[model samples]
Target: MSILKLKPSCKDYLWGGSRLIKEYGKEYEGEVLAETWELSCHPDGPSVIRNGAYAGKTLPEYISGEGRQVLGTHCRRFRDFPILTKFIDARDNLSIQVHPDNRYALKNEGQYGKTEMWYVMDAGKDAFLYYGFQREITKEEFAQRIREDTLLEVLNAVPVQKGDVLFIESGTIHAIGKDILIAEIQQNSNVTYRVYDYGRVGKDGKKRDLHIEKALAVTNRIPIVRKNSSYPHAADCDYFTVDKLNLDGRVMQKLSGKVSEESFASILILDGEGTISDEREELAYHKGDSFFLSAGSGTYTIEGSCDALVTTIREKAAQVRIGIDIGGADTRIGLVDVHQKLIAWKTVRTNAMRPAKEVIQEIGQTALSLLEEQGIAMEQCVGAGIGVPGTVDRKNGVVRYSNNIKWEDVDIAKEMGACLPIPIYIANDADCAALGEAAAGAGRGCEDVILFTLGTGVGGGVILDGSIYEGSGISGSELGHMVIVENGEPCTCGRRGCLEAYVSVPALIREALAAAGKELTPEEIFAAAKEDPVVKEVVDTYIRRLGTGIVNAVNIFRPRLVILGGRISEQGDVLIKPLEEQLRQGCFGGEKSGIPEIRTAVLGSHAGMIGAASLI
Candidate 1:
């Protein structure tokens, strides 16, 4: 069908009010109408088609019968339906919670993460809600405050009014305050990591479970850097783009538009009554009405005064950069668009034991093969960046020294450039990760950022004033070599008490073996720390030492963001919370100077690849 009206699935949450039912005309048998899934394909609650031949069928069922084309060509990249629209009425404070990113949610929860926008429809006097943090806070302080029930003191309580629009990305800690109604459009996911519930109880008379560990893993512990609100469009991002429509009925009683093949259009009516019509069909829409217009439906017209949100998918660009992360064991290469989206990728084993020229040739050939498979031309590429695991003399395109790859004085760029058609650049793999994160991931929007890769060894990269701060010599910034202990553990760099000695994955496992008499994986060590005091001590010591190194880096560089990466970082909040505490205590000047936000690197394994691409 070209135009289909949707019936929402209602919810009777404990903190819900009746505003949606009384004011927005939502029909629900529940005593309290908390939320309405207006346009959704989520398994828990799906919107049903109310009119046309698809009436009584859920949105997913209709889409299945109509074929995927109904969703539009712009939606082809997605594995499932892309967006979910809802209406919520809060009579009391909702829980303080955080949503994970796609990588974290998909790995642990078997679903996509949420990135949502809230349009305030109505609010009571002095109505406010928690958005993020009032200021930068350490994971340690965040946990302490949660246990003390004082989290609200540090949260940024936004005083919202009707018509205000708030875009909440994944990882932002937020809650809806009492006496407010909101229209929310978000990714098609229901994953929420609730951190605090105001000690509230569920129907069973027990406090609702708080996902403290998970929340800590995902919550961005800093005030959101608000964007300029005077943009041409209402809200635009990778998932969906929404535009506001207003017709005064006097000066502009009618508006016309076309539903193109690129994207299907979703119309969420916020206020006023109107008649929406196409060439063959016309339907009356009131407040809270939801309508779906199939792609390529030709011209459509709307008459009568109305305020609405028109949402559609935005297609990605074809132009991309090639990123190559060269490790001793393997190399990961990918194509990343201007938006920093990784379009396609491939992993190839790196025979680093071979001569540098041969390895570079293989990597270059692999990149070319990937491009050919993706139907990409050399002209479409901006350039290629290579992340080498070693001391890289970027200016001369040489690998000065790399113990892992057993390469020294090798011309990586020159060798690779010979086989690839694009210009080539190279840097330390750790440095690439820092650059990638600062450019597009957790450290985006921050001028000064630091990244620590805590895997087999502690590796680091420093971005100061929007550029990598390579020291005066070709030795590069060996942040992991900085001494933390007076004469503690032996480091791989043949030093005593360097940060790497105590903070790396091997270091943690070593400590566990010494203290607990059993060797364990990083995941097992963290899990055991919850129950085994012996393992807890080992983990605590690791965090303490890790914090010491971070404190030293922060004092010297004064960065705004500190990112934790590498394999060990997968522990998430289990690793971050305690480490943040030590940094808070040991950091010079403490809160007097703004504390840098400590976060887990969101780019994961692709950080090196994306970071390498940023060199272009």
Candidate 2:
């Protein structure tokens, strides 16, 4: 049903009050009812589904049972459920603490970051709380205060009443005051760096440990001037957006809303009793109750006398990306959306003789034309990605060198950004092609992948854990340059016996010309190699060299997939079979370590463009 009511997980901390039992109808039989995790998916204290097809199940179980789409499109960007809601009844003041941002928390705590908003449901007459530093303080002074038990003097003490809102962003030191009941909407992360605990002993009769060093590293030791942002939102941050819902049963008995595919809706009822209904079913709700509505569930009505906080994810106008493929002769531009759909496409002739600035300008104009044709606004565009055929300084978005396009040390992204006015990402054409395969072609569903591109010259891309591996200094993954023979053949890279010298299409055609005494295309060479003994020897040597290279890559990276792309890949099983046998014979662990599956890329020529677009 639409209204999936939840049963909160209760905590019985030492400073908790029984107000949750006397007022909020909490059925907990513990010594204290400190906090109620009303809408939680964390493993430590998961909320239970009270009414639905998946009744009596944990929130995580319900999520798994209903597909991740239930969390909505915005949530899909997160690896786990994005938000957590809870009710806190603090009988005593909480310890002064701060939380880390995503980068710090993810590295140290192995979880997402915390940025929370608190709504004062009720508070004592003289209740007050710490907001942040009253004024700018030196790190040394802040540390000294904590050591001397004078931290409260530097903290900003603000008196609070019912219906007050305080946004506690990550790194802002804050604490809840005694005799305060609050409804908190926060990120899923539970990392907190406690600086002080008022010398209060825990159940084991020892003071709560202080993460002083960690707190110093993360805390914002400065006065916090709350911004009165008029975005028509209570808390409109990256993690979540919350809006207050005050319904009067006497006048308006029902509050209707629509949850689009963009975000799931959550209702945390703080007061009153009522029933939420939709086309599916009706659910009764009370104080301290929580309801989860899946995304794209269409229209729904909340019919009740209640005070609630409605939460949903706020998103950009669109998640579309601009993809550019800088080819030697023709450059292609495309617009790809979050759904991986190529919504708009265009192509322009590239005058390599023109200045790089003029050429880049023309490419940017072509992208705008595609958007106009599709009736898409530039504001809806996320970012732009360009794939250039050469070594690229991906970080600087500069094309270091491209033999195919005759470009060297060109700041492609900087020039394009002048017109596009969005973030620009640049990557090597081969790496982009490999990304395309991993995302939508043969390498899909695999994390680690190695792509061998055997065209005029052999080049490859190494993908580690779904991202391009540039190795040290953004100049690595030159797999085709690995020498397979001791001074056997000269290579374009000015090296002797390189794998590219033997396995590349140009190399094969040259070998066939020497043996068959006729210049021919790779296809014609392959056909002749099947009949002529002299041509067969050259073909066998080519395959054997390629097999050696493939085996070496497998043994080193141990990728889950090894894709063969370029013109040679068109042969499919003809090349894959012999390569597989050769790997089995020579590779140290191709079979025992589970030989990486060999597959031909499915996206073909468009792979470069598609992969570039995904950079957004």
Candidate 3:
């Protein structure tokens, strides 16, 4: 089946204080404003009705009767469907604003608060966006400024490129400047409290009411400036994470892993063009394209020649510390600790997969000392797990083949066990991720789970009945090798139409370069996806294919839960909704009731390490 399609409705201005004609050109003049295009709610948008005899009816109307039977209470608001889509055109700058948390919004606005990202469509040179205030301003100080019309003095104005993307958390004070168009994907709510505006008149020639009291109540005093370059810095927060991608040359970048349960990714291609390949399909993207890749145990790859931007979302932590030991070209080990709950150690060398004995020896000498200091004896340590970038025989603990690590048929677990006098586990990095989730993170407490990781190459892992499911000598669960399209694209696995052929990180980056007509990174592609529809189309196709693969997994396993991990998972709902929709449309079963609960993986990079530890 084809990907699920959402119908969008437009909103018209000329009412109350909302400006319409002036903000948008005559094409939107006297016409309805395009508020949202998805099947969810905006109060001003359209809804998706169930297909059948009542196909054209509103979702609400259909749900009131026969539709209720086909789609049960499992999805009262909407089954496997995303909640909303928002569109904004800044004629003049919007008032600096902020949204409250869900509880606060329900109490005050009788709706959900918005947590959203902006994908710039059209921007003038030197365009700007309001992210946070300049400094910590006391409520009294903000109140006085609001009364005197001097709020802009306290706000930070960051210049924007045409394809820039910025994440606006619930309490962030922000606004869009004039001559900019944005497609805003957010939670299903419209409870923005306007703190300040440029004193502009509406189409009705009346001043808009300022929500000074509410704005001051929710505004975060910390100042923030959206970075202007392709690769802007990232600031982790409890709600979400925002980062910029600037791709140059044929580069494949991996996100620095974090320890967090439930993360998502939003890839917005700011410029250039190329295709993002994953385990299942290939996504051709250009500018203004946004696609969501679920982060699980699977690794995905992207490739192209144009520049792009990518953003990842994951759990926030109090502190994240990393220990790096650069070992020339032999092997470099990186150790990461997050709030003491998670730890990840990685070894990279000029070769693809190191000899099992060599890896065991290095891990023992380097990481074991640190583990002992942490009260874990070499024997008390659960298991030592290793991830090679290439193929693996997880069941037999054999490194099948790794072009990067340069190893084949090496018994990793056996060799490690001999060295440490403890149980040792080994799998492809992606499979290790599946074990990680099952042992500690998102898939914890669930008997059956599936994980997909998005990176240079798509990787996958499955857990069934409380244990990692390695099929037929551990050759199974190679989800990245699955083919979603016939004769689609070439993959590193030496196969065409494989999932990695379309949705891998390298593939996504490549698509961004092609769109911009220059080389860039995944972060740059994300920025471009905000403003360029061509990029958006590429992302949309990628997202749809990703969803299709997920649906296929769901149909085959029908697991109780599905957790998305890795960097691509940072896209969050941008990828989740469409994928969920596809699953719903494809899955056939009894009662049309509760299927699998699909969520972002809670464990971030630590999943593999912890899972490996669990093996002890």
Q: Rate the local accuracy (lDDT) of all candidates.
A: 0.87, 0.85, 0.58
Compared with the true structure, the alpha-carbon lDDT of candidate 3 equals: 0.58
TM value for model 3 = 0.43
Predicted candidate 1 versus true structure: per-residue lDDT over 162-243, tens digit per residue: 9988999999999999989899999998999999998899999999999999998889998997765937778887788999
Q: How well is each residue in 471-541 modelled by candidate 3, as lDDT tens digits?
A: 66655578878899898888887778888888888778776667657766665666667888888777887
CA RMSD of all predictions: 23.3, 15.7, 27.1
Ranking by lDDT: 1, 2, 3
Model 3 per-residue lDDT at 66:
39
The candidate with the higher lDDT, 1 or 3, is 1
TM-scores of the models, in the order given: 0.55, 0.61, 0.43
Q: Taking the tens digit of each residue's C-alpha lDDT, what string does model 2 give over 316-423?
A: 645778888888888888888877667768888887888889999889878877777887755456678898887899978888887777788999878886667556
| Model 2 regions more than 4 Å off | 228-231, 316-453, 456-510, 516-616
Instruction: Summing lDDT over every window of 10 consecutive residues in candidate 2, give the lowest-scoring window.
Output: 103-112
Residue 1 accuracy (lDDT) in model 1? 66
